[model samples]
Target: MAVSHGHKGINFAQTTSICLNFIQEALLKHQWQRASEFLQHYFQALEDFNSQKRQVALQNIWKLGSAILYHHPKSNVETFNAFADRMKNIGVQNYLKISLQHALYLLHKGMVEEAYRNLNQAESWRYGEMSASQEKIIKLIQAYRGLLDYYTWSKKRTELSKFDMDGFATSAATQDMHSYFRQASVNLHEIIKIPGVWDPFVKSYVEMLEFYGDQDGARQVLTDYAYDNNFPSNPNAHIYLYKFLKKEKAPEDKLISVLKILHQIVPSHKIMLEFHMLLRKSKKEEHQKLGLEVLFAVLDFSGCTENITAWKYLAKYLKQIMMEKHLNWVQEGWSSRKDWWPTFHFSYYLAKKNWKENKILALEKAFTSGILLGKGCKYFMYVSKQGHKVQKKSIKTMKKFVMKHNILDSEEL
Candidate 1:
């Protein structure tokens, strides 16, 4: 569809599709700057259009740009810098974020000099009429600047010479360590006070504090970072506190508290084995119950269905629960979770010998999740000694579902 704008016919839909194609072609050839230029032209071509098509096109454009920029390790200074400049010229609202993201990538790659340059550029983007979010980003940019300066100083801490900082040479000599340390400390201090979780910033500050023999300061910052209410939740911040407490030889309750929150937030976290082990050893009745709950959560995850370690823990705990006459867990949460695990399925369609065959069991174990149900295995619907009434009902339901969804029955497979 074409619309007339100032005596010129512009087609928003066609232009958007063509522009995206051009951008993808550039990306396939690793031409970042070319792709960015195409995006800019796309925006300019639709500058005067105010319609649903234009709004949807703009959303797609931003999503494409974000998806491309998120892979920072694949980008370089020259190409990213060119792309960022074009985005800035196009007045992209998140140009600041793009700059900081690339700067972060540079820092991770040990390119402190380039990271510093990019951070400085990001700070420059924080010009007049800043919104609340932009202001927060500016503070983050400053904190990263401090981090970049500290990294630069640490690499040359053995020297007593001048070094480059923000494109100027400074002579802190041996004192550069403390100077950069204080610079980072002050910036991070401001950031933490803003009531948000700054994991990396707070973590780095804690390391510096520990190196400087300030234990109390490290503890305080970590506590605040973990327990703050600025964001919904941050699981790793709890992890940081947990490790720190273990190092400080703090009380068992403190470590347990941290791990409990972490488990609630991320049930499949790899470090949860430590929490499970700790709980399993506790003599408290409540702790044992919590331990069972944790095991169920761990196994419910799709990736963890075959996790042997988790299965082993569940086995030991289930044995303990049965011996203690606690059948409530079986009828409660465990049954729902067990429904998703493939290893416990009971199908009755085959002969008794075939049902007890190890080879058939192994084959079923190799498949994930659904075979024990009435759906995929109409002939062999459950692993139970219960009568044919249940089996017949399962078969009827499975047939209806199969007919509706057009899924192949067991005979076909």
Candidate 2:
């Protein structure tokens, strides 16, 4: 199953497999640069191959494309599309996936008509397929179609509100409204019946319910589908539930109860952060203490996004709490991770407060982690000046590292 490239019998399939293996290994190790390099090699190796080999290459290309989408949402669109066009040229007929992506991209850019047309094309492609995979794709297409229709109706409704509608035009609008809702209901029902875990379709349905001013309906749907099961990984569903309860102004006790349930179910950094946010809304020391606990939980859950704001706020809380307790947070060595951006700031604050050698050691740990200086280098140095003088060797090393990496200076305090 090897595709021979040149007279020397270069095996493209073996090389491609090796590249994929290396990519996976790099990703597993969180070596993103290495993973990206391997992906580029895979793409290069697949170019200009025969049709038989092209299909397999396209499959791997899509795999890499999806991984890129997940890891780096703001990646180059032209490059992605170039790969996609190459895939299409190789006789891969799964245009629905491509069209849906394009539709969403267009919609995000506010090209409503183009987005609508792309969605319609995706819907048309759904008619002739009945495979298990196709069924999932069809459900997704239905969700997007319903979303597009909702957006269109909303825009038209806004425009119609400015005019004195004649009877004929009013009737036409009424008919359109009826047709839209009827189709929406059908899509919602089908999505609900699809047997599996919750997905983007479920999120879309919940959004549609919310858009139609059915807050209760949206809450019920999320509760039944998203929360009724084990810990769901969908952040949108969690946010939707929190927003609904917040809008209702649920009691503190009730909110705490729900937070406890969500925390126990997921135990991730987001839920912990949300719990802290909720506690911050309260005007009491005990609630703030609870918020501090939530911060600790955030550090405990390593799956959190690299949220600098949360870490900075957490440092402030730690300082405040330590002052009240008449203790040194620096001595406590309160750091979640040594190699994260937040750790640098946290260590800086600890060093400034204590002015101890141990604190300097902690700061050195954060500096060497290589994750600290992205946008906080100047501020880090500012805080360092407030504390004990950093070692000359350490300063020189940091200077070299910054120069090599070209981290932009941020005038943040």
Q: Pick the candidate with the highest lDDT.
A: 1
The residue-level lDDT of candidate 1 at 324 comes to 74
Model 2: residues with Cα > 4 Å off, grouped in runs: 1-6, 9-54, 58-115, 118-129, 161-171, 192-204, 207-213, 261-292, 298-413
lDDT of 1: 0.63
Q: Which residue pairs in model 1 clash with each other?
A: 346-382, 346-383, 347-382
TM-scores of the candidates are 0.64, 0.52
lDDT of 1 by residue, 1-413 (tens): 12123534446655666777887887788676677667666664446466555555555565556546645346555665565566555455566766787677676667878888888877876456888888888898998887666565566564533444542234445466778888778887887787666777778788878878999999998888888777558887889989999999987667778999999899988778778877878877777677878877886776774465675566556556655756565345445644444343323333243334532332232121222233444223342332445354543543443344321223322
Residue 68 displacement in candidate 1 (angstroms): 7.4
CA deviation > 4 Å runs, candidate 1? 1-43, 46-76, 86-110, 121-130, 153-174, 195-197, 324-333, 338-413
Per-candidate RMSD vs. true structure? 11.4, 13.1
TM-score of the candidate numbered 2? 0.52
